[model samples]
Target: MNASRTPLFCDTVLAERIERAEARLMAECCEAAQRGDSPGFVHVLAGGVASFAEDGSPYNKVAGLGFHGVPSAADLDDVEKAFAAHGAVVQVELAHLADPAIGVLLTERGYRLESFENVLGLALDGEYEPVALPGFVIRRSGDDEFEQWLEVVADGAAHPDTQGLPWHEEFPREIYLRAQRHSAAAGEQHYVAVRDGAFVGGAGLRVSEGIAQFAGAATAPAHRRRGVQSALLAARLADARAAGCDVAVITTQPGSKSQQNAQRQGFDLLYTRAVLVKQP
Candidate 1:
């Protein structure tokens, strides 16, 4: 029997680039929230907004009640009520300066803490080193190659913990399909990593306003532990530089492997955010 090859992980610099890409996304989400645009924020949350808060969504799953801003103690009741009415989850973000007591209040009221994350960023002008993985091939993904990309996402989804909180079962399918459409419309680059003509992993790079955000990075189950992710990231960063981005940003859970992954690639934590989950 052939021995299983060990999956490769990213080094410090690539991790930093991933975190930098996350930062750009967080800023966009925060900006949408500040504008009181529920639909806009959800789209950002969905990786990109295709349709705005379409009516009759089960669980207001689309709106993600109270995600826009902090709700007052009294307002929390109303927000919870609204969430219950829609059979959905209500989330609130407390910044570093927010009182720690808020968690106690939520727990006392039956709301559980869902997750925490450290948002990281790197100036577009910051220096980043490129690492070469000679055997793997990375290149732009075209319309014909999209199904292979989807397969990696679907395979990764088998692990719920690794799949990320499922916003919608159809969300990923829609996002992947629509992203290609949008990128084609906008003339952006979507990339895939192949080893001997077989897809190993992929990432999306969109440059807007001089910043590049990395989205939809995934490696196949058989390809995990190999340097696929690291190689894909390095390729993306070089692409970001070639496109003239001034900075990169990404958001990640503080203690999760993703965080460690970002640090392994050299990302510095820019800030931390708490997403408070309450029972509806």
Candidate 2:
């Protein structure tokens, strides 16, 4: 894979850019819930917000802090208390763009480094050759098909290869459904891969600030190795490019098959981010 860099991947700006994007997305989800367009609630914070579902959603977490500068100890203390009030674990995703001192502060405050995710990006300045999965069809999903799309995605996520991974927990069906609805309400584009009119895989795309992010992508167990995901990626990238995005990004576990697939498709490592958590 090419190691070319863009402003979004620059060491000095990468963290903040990612944090901003995440914060924006989360805030939008909160708005959707407040408007009764979806399920969930948003708790505004000093520099970020806490997102929660009526049922426990691991998605409930804090984001977009320590970007302008390292947060004060008192500020961190308050943030922890706020998350605790919501009966949620204090989880934070710190990126390289954050002030280096933020890590030191988190460590001092009882947060443990949980895991790392490789952020990969692909520039959409050139022609993209669409991958053809001979017997599969990929298309954007509509509101009426949300449940079917969620089922396929949840099944794909539960595939054995994804078990025990931080990102692959099997939440209650209600939680998944609510989250999917909230995501759609927040403007995420859902896509599904089908063969013979049956769902085989699914993915989600969110575009902002000239960038398109492949937020979620998975293929059913029986559909693995059949280029289902590649076809989905191709379709999403083409759609994003046509919509005027200059870059496309995705995150995956380091050294996983997903990461390998992304690399094969011209995505390069932008940075690895740390997921930190403090249990009550």
Candidate 3:
């Protein structure tokens, strides 16, 4: 680890690159719904995509907008219509660096600010100190443990720590479980934190275009403050860096313990996204 600060500028090129990779992941996650008793749909509008997991689902929203090109007022109209057709709200996690005019267009079309999420980044141009927790064993999940991983992750999500911005909506545990299944179908690398042969935490990672997305993670309710998540994060960071990614990005609730933990691990705030919604 470098004692000095890491230099990373969140310029348009960087933002665009990150945004595109993330949006592709979202769509890929949705694409997983095409398999085995899933209830998700994906629609491409202009350049971006809208995904529907279920009516009123948090996964039902638009993403990747204003990236390939600035979407027109009519383009947004079609986007809204696409989600509306499925009885879902038109939601967009618009990056602050996106064309200012696009945000203006969304506002003019009635999308209201609902919340914000922080994106922390770590430049992997150098080496990182290895991390190991004494009481926990962290490793990649096995094929036979998919159900176990899903149960652990969904359980943790159901009992999220109260240390960050509260979720905008409360999803059922089943929703989280289904989400993990989709992530698996999209080829996300899964990791588990085990203590005494029991899974205490689970997380996922996906790499695209030299950027590693800490796709999602959660710690079990009974294991919240025992450093399980930190251990998992450190392992993932080192692995991602080893995979040749130039930078890693993770989205977290503003002021979340997750965000705090990431900051301690050499990741800094690269950007914040405004979550906007237009009810259907």
Candidate 4:
């Protein structure tokens, strides 16, 4: 750490950069998933991307909107039509820092409020030390261990910690696994935790545009209250700094355990997004 160099803080420019990176990653995941047997759909817009991973899949939504100024009505129409083609509802995650006019447009278009997600950030300009976990081993997952990692992560997601707001909905186990695979294919780095030679937790990290995205992570039901998640978070932060990321980010249900964990790890509440939905 340079004593003379000032620490990084979240500003409009930084927020926009992070949000745009997230949007791009979402699009990439959609494209990567489409290459598989599932055959999903992706719609690219000037403001963001709309994706449809599968029927009733959580990836079926629009992200990265309102940052490039308000999106045109015609573009929104096109996005809606794309999802409607699959008999799916159009779900939009709009950042609060975005142009307010975009929210107005969505309201006029009959998009109703759904939920909010908080995006927290940690500046990676300084050094990050590895987290310590007694009786636990943590390391990046190998390609051959993907199935084991997926099983642990899915089980963790199915039974989230009760520290904060719950998720709006849950996807089927198979669909969730597919989403995880697509994320991995989109350059997400996977990390696993083990205790007594058994996989106990799994997490993911992705770096794009100097941003390290702390993707979803979960611990085995029996591993909660331990330092598995904190260790995984630290490991990713250290790796992201090594990768030269300017900031690290994670999104979670407002006030959830994930949010609490990030905060405890020195992350600040940078901004939030409103989840709006319009049915076909």
The numbered model that scores best in lDDT is 4
2 or 4, greater by TM-score? 4
Q: Best TM-score goes to which candidate?
A: 4
lDDT of 1 by residue, 36-113 (tens): 434322223322111222122211221222123333567556556655654566655433333356556656767665
Ranking by lDDT: 4, 3, 2, 1
Expressed as tens digits, the lDDT of each residue in 34-97 for candidate 2 is 5763355565554556565444664666777666666766766776676676666777777755
204-224 in candidate 4: lDDT tens per residue?
999998999998699988889
Local lDDT at 79 for model 1: 53
Question: What global local distance difference test value does model 1 have?
Answer: 0.51
What total of clashing residue pairs does each candidate reach?
Answer: 27, 1, 0, 0
List pairs with backbone clashes in candidate 2.
15-97
Query: Per-residue lDDT tens digits of candidate 3, residues 13-74?
Result: 88888887877777887777756554667777546677876654556777766666777667
TM-score of each: 0.59, 0.87, 0.94, 0.95
**Candidates sorted on TM-score, descending:** 4, 3, 2, 1
lDDT of each model, Cα atoms only?
Answer: 0.51, 0.74, 0.80, 0.85
Q: What lDDT score is found at residue 207 in candidate 4?
A: 91
Error of 1 at 89 (Å): 1.2
Worst 10 residues of 1 by lDDT: 46-55
